[model samples]
Target: MKVVPSRSSEWVGPVTSQKRASAIIEIDRVSQVFQTSARKDHLALSNISLTIEEGAFVSILGPSGCGKSTLLYIVGGFVSPTSGAAKIKGQAITGPGPDRGPVFQEFALFPWKTVLGNVMYGPRQQGVRAAEAEAQSRALIEMVGLKGYESFYPKELSGGMKQRVALARTLAYHPEVLLMDEPFGALDAHTRTRLQNDLLNIWERDRKTVLFVTHSVDEAVFLSDKVVMMSKSPGCIREVIDIDLPRPRRRNELLLDPRYQKYIVNIERMFDESDEAGAPS
Candidate 1:
């Protein structure tokens, strides 16, 4: 199925050449801590730092309990760091705003609303007029392959479909940065793979700065320009691996490419050598 992108999001190929690289989002020595019921301070992240250039698709890969999601949350402004800061365009992020849109592991749609209503919710709240919001929402619904189900409520949709709605909703508001935390983690193997490819197409078209978190090696290898691995417990960057493979990456070809396999192996080695838990590449 073809994704019908709105003219507002016209195609810019996956590997479009740019004049100069510039950092759009900066994670500066960020750390996070939580107080346990016993009053012990539980440190979740320790001095994590990263800089994502504009229009780059970067993935945060780590095992369970690695605090990857916490890092993404801080960047999304849904949570504040204990120290340091998450900044976008050189401005410190204080709270959730229109500039950065987040799609979580769980689909957070309103059960009472239809698919169209859910997609339109963000723009309407942001003060876009009804007619214009509907036009943009319909285009996004088509992009995510939910055009025919516009009137269907969340209860009527499958897990993958609900996630698609969540994605469509996020894209409808035209965020410069898309912060996704395990958006496809809940889906079955086939659905997960399908969405991964589709997401690549969407990213290629829009060129938004993507900060994605996942435990899957194949996912990181196939989708990201850079893959940053994290350590266990008090998560910190173990290594930042650059994926040198050409973009408009085809999954079947990537599976067979020697460089792709090397990247996967190197990523796996980072975890194996460091005693950090990980999934098979």
Candidate 2:
């Protein structure tokens, strides 16, 4: 797996009168493996290291089985690495905490809950009063452009709308970091594009630290300030490309740009090479 240099040096943590803050999430020399049968081992991630600045948008891109989702879970504290450290701010992440919110691709909304109820759930768990949670939920629902859908249950909403509620629920927690695992993967192409644009718009406004994982190269290039490409199998950082493209980008026009295509091709080549290496000898 190819290793990428860190671009997180620019990320300044929350300011205080004394010491300066650090990156919101930092992974150093992380390797994760799972055991199968009696002794066979499968390394899902290997020697991966990266840092995400507070409030910066970053995406992990690679082909399937590249351990992208595993990396996301590591950041979310849902799983621990077999070795190395995953830290939030300056603290070690040993388990899940309210400080980091996660959005799964499956939407994962409870079928029994209304949009507002789903959004309010996080805050309620965080010990916020019912009324306060409701108010926060209402504002976040509107922020995700789901204002009128508040009373509707998950089953009543379209796939895109359901994901929006899931997103709002994560936001309602007001997490210091947000982790998303291909949150738009199941949507139709048109819906995917729309939701991608909407997500970028909301992100720019909300300015939360985001660590998004996806196999879609376009999605990574479109939404992230930096796209961290990973190698397949036993995933590791291949390259960290600074997007540098103007924000609020139009999909049609940006896709046509030669520079945008360059990043996509670069990531594509890495995936192809990794696949070749992983093939049976």
Candidate 3:
């Protein structure tokens, strides 16, 4: 495994010459403000700027209320920033499009629809013929490890299975980027780990650009090429740490690897320091 240098928040240099040339998503000085019932302005994200290279798995790791999901939604074009802009492949993002797919923590599956029906919905909506859509959906369901459960409805599947269907549905339309907002957050520890491993395996096939938001340090370190740490509310970039571990990472091996352990320890320490810094004097 090669040692990779981490960059501070102030470091504006590109990750590498190759990545710099193929920047797939660009967020330029984006800020989000919301008005509370009390009539005060609440700033969620403050002047966040980030560049994600094509096929890179990037994790947005931050504390709760740090606007991590808000940022993800911005890139998905689900919400408009108060200022600045987000772009995909050089075009400004004005609204949600098939180019980006979002998988949320809430399974968001149609309880009325079975696994096959749910996964096929996206393609059918895109005007794909029913037979073709079913074929693609069945393949995706199998790829997500739900081969025999295609006919099962959301109510009949486990939480993990539901999430898998959600993932397949998102992938059905062939989005260029995957915006995953704590997609595994609702699962038990064992289930979450399994899904994490499964996600990496599926990701290895096509290497779709993924922007994953999570509060877990270990999860971020394990799944991402770069982990972008954010500050507390009115979140800003705190640091961007590049994971230098060799690819095709296995959970059993990574658990024993000193480098992986160090990354978790160091990131936790940074979060602790940030908390202390924000404590009232």
Point to the candidate with the largest lDDT: 3
Quantify all predictions' global Cα lDDT against the true fold: 0.85, 0.83, 0.91
lDDT of 1 by residue, 230-268 (tens): 887678888776666776888999999987887788778
Off by over 4 Å in 1: 1-21, 276-281
TM-score of each: 0.90, 0.88, 0.94
Q: What is the C-alpha RMSD of each candidate to the true structure, in Å?
A: 7.0, 5.5, 3.3
Between 1 and 3, whose lDDT is larger? 3
Least well predicted 10-residue stretch by lDDT in candidate 1: 1-10
Evaluate model 3: give its lDDT.
0.91
Per-residue alpha-carbon lDDT of candidate 3 for residues 162-225, written as tens digits (9 for 90 to 100): 9999999999999999999999999999999999999999998888999999999999999988
> Model 2 Cα displacement at 29 (Å)?
1.5
Model 3's number of clashes is: 0
Ranking by lDDT: 3, 1, 2
- Each model's number of backbone clashes? 0, 0, 0
Cα RMSD (Å) between model 2 and the true structure?
5.5
